[model samples]
Target chain A: MEQGIQIVSILIAGVIFYGGVGWLLDRWLGTMFWTPCGIIVGTALGVYWVVKKYGQAR
Target chain B: MGGFLIPLEGEWVSPGVHSFDSRPLFPGVLPDWVNGHLAQAVIGAALVIGFWLWVSRRQQIVPTKRQFVGEWLYDFVRNNISREALGPDYRKYHPYLLALFSFILVNNLFGEFFVFMFPTFSKIGYAYGLAVASWVLYNAAGIKRDGFGHYMKKMTLPEGVPIYMAWLIIPLEFLSNFIVRPFTLALRLFANLFAGHLVILVFVLGGTYLLTLKDNLFYNFSGGVSILFSFAIFALEIFIGALQAYIFTVLTAQYVHSSISEEH
Candidate 1:
């Protein structure tokens, strides 16, 4: 349960942080679709981080 | 069971977030700071302190029942939680871990107790306060052990990430470590206690309301059943209360361990 919570939190943190940045960049660049792309990228990165940090046998 | 669906004269509104409000125990006699939840916190602290004091005052080689229980709790926190999570250097943090566990356990159990029916952490502020304290402790420990520059690098920079990927990893690491850790810590505890108490309230209050329905045999019977089930919920709440305390303490220890460890 604790590991699950940590994973979900990391995913959420990734999406929020990167997605917010994407949204701002979209506004600056006069585009409208960067947010979702950012979220997807963020999620992949987040999962990689989790796998590296916690998924291995310690 | 279909007959139990008795139409009510008024809406049977379920208890909502407002149910967690901390009303003054005494309407006007005490100061405003003395509210139900605050009083419960004070009582919880007093209970923890008093219990430890009583146990520590009498050091028995052959322990009595009370002393045995007290020692068991201390050992559980010190050995099972702090030592397991913090590794070989766990002794320095045993006191904080034990205090945190005991204090949280008492406050969480307050909801189950007859006198104080509110868990203090349901207030959110208290949970955040504890989380911030843990946050500060871990970060300070890391910085103290490794200089501030080294600690920042260790925390925000991954061990094996390529230099090209540092842009993404750094921000994510920063947010995960510095921002999300404390936020999730506080929200996890506050949400669990708040939702747990709200569930009990729904059952108990709804059961009472159903029982009070006029001339409805099925509603009354179902209400009794609801109230009976609430006792089971109360048992689950107690388990969750203790489980959350352990989780919070262990996670804190893990965070501290991660902070002061040689590698991330």
Candidate 2:
């Protein structure tokens, strides 16, 4: 249950961060470029690095 | 069946349309009022289909003006997304990806045409289907690139990490990369389009609500402003809908690119 919660929590943050950045970039630059995609890949990689070393060990 | 009940005075029920307020508006179930979303979807689909049918029937290589416009948009997606993201092999994927992008772009923009203002992408199911298609392509491409064993390992392992870190990293990596990423893609598109539709709905509905107030000077003034704001939002929605579709397709293509790249 706790693990499930963690996964969901990570997802909420990912949505806000990725969607927020993409939206801001679109509003500012008036183009749908890599900002949204970058946020997704970046956050995905960051969590993978963090959890692989710390969370899974437990 | 759920088709028999239409409240003529208050609530109208339809397959895809729902009211914003969540109240049981149980009265006006007229065909004209209850099925707004489906009506819009049909009209939108018909317009695209009609345009294509007409264009294809009269297509020419000598550069008629209509053909030029069609070819321009077709080439835009092909070159920008298919060629750029997938490289030289993009020709094989161009048809599917191009259709996906244009279908979404048209459906999203269709909301601007009338009082029936629902962008099809705002429906989560459509976004989910599109996302799953991209997900399948990415994983399939990965498997094809590295073979099954290597693909799995590459996805779960980061380069230069300590061997002991595998315990923590693998699950997190697997979950984020393999499981949730596609869902986020779908939700992001769905939520943005959905919110945009909702804002338009509020503005239009606000105008209607204000106009319904007693026939006084203040009511008319407020109602006029509400109508103006709604029109402004409708215009913004046209741009936003196309932009969201473009963003969704480009990101999907990029994901496929990353999957097959040597850096992975």
Candidate 3:
């Protein structure tokens, strides 16, 4: 249960962190596309982090 | 059945988030700071402190009933939660773990009680406050145990990662550790209590509303059923309240353990 909550937090954190970056970039460049791209990338990275930290043999 | 036919004065409005809002217990006499949940929190704190004090006032070679209960609570948190989660260093943090468990459990049980039907944590601020405290404690412990720079590096840069992937991994690690931990911790507790209270409201109020629908025998029958189900839900709320308290305390211990441990 604790691990499950932590994993979820990581996923949300990833989206918020990278998505915020993407939004900032979009604002600077005046492009509408960067936000979605950032979210996708952020999610991918978040999943990767989860796998890296938790997926391996103990 | 005919006696139950009297109609309710107002429409049965299903409870929503607004249900959590507090009307001042004292309309104008009490200061603005004193509201239902705030008062409940204060009461909960007092109850926890008083109970512990009463239990610990006299040392016994054998044990009284009160002492037994107190010892059971202490041992439960110390052995089951802190020891199991924090390992050899658990004793260092036992007091904190015990306090947190008792405080939360009392406040949560408030929701099921008659006079104070609000779980203090259903208010998001209280949950966030506890989370922030835990966050600071764990991070500080980590930094204190390992040097600040070393801790930061260890937290952000995992072992066995490729050098080329450092850029990608660093930000993710930073966000996961620094940002997500507290956010999820608060949200999990807040959401559970908020939803649990809301569910109870729906069942009880809906059932009461149904009981007043005297025009239909079916409605009256189902209303009785709904009220009965609400009792079962009340029982569930109590169990969840205790479980959430345990879960929160255990996770806090785990975070502390991870922070101070040599291995991640």
Supply the TM-score of chain A against the true chain A for every candidate structure: 0.85, 0.58, 0.93
- i-RMSD of model 3 (Å, 1 decimal): 1.7
Off by over 4 Å in 1: A1-9, A26-31, A51-58, B1-12, B25-33
Q: Write the per-residue lDDT of candidate 3 for residues B90-191, one digit (tens) a residue.
A: 888888889889999999999999888889999999999999989998999999999999999988887877899889878877888888788877988999
Identify the candidate with maximal TM-score: 3
**Using lDDT as the measure, which candidate wins?**
1
Model 2: number of backbone collisions: 16
Local error of candidate 2 at B243, Å?
0.5
| Residue range B1-264, candidate 1, lDDT tens digits | 345554533578789988877788787788877887787788898999998998887778999988898889888888889888887899998898899999999999998988888889989999999999999999999999999999999988868878888888888888888899999889999999999999999999899778767799999899989999999999999999999999899889888988999885
Docking class of 3: medium
Candidate 2 docks at the CAPRI level of incorrect
Deviation from native of the Cα of residue B141 in model 3, angstroms:
1.4
Q: Quote the positional error of residue B49 for candidate 2 in Å.
A: 6.1
Q: Could you tell me the lDDT of residue B29 within candidate 2?
A: 60
- Candidate 1, residue B221: Cα displacement in angstroms equals 1.2
Model 2, residue B149: distance off in Å is 1.9
- What C-alpha RMSD separates each model from the true structure? 4.1, 12.4, 2.5
Model 1 chain B weakest 10-residue run by lDDT: B1-10
Error of 3 at B83 (Å): 0.5
- Complex DockQ, candidate 1: 0.55
- The per-residue C-alpha lDDT of model 3 at residue B257 equals 83
Error of 2 at B59 (Å): 5.4
TM per candidate, chain B: 0.92, 0.79, 0.94
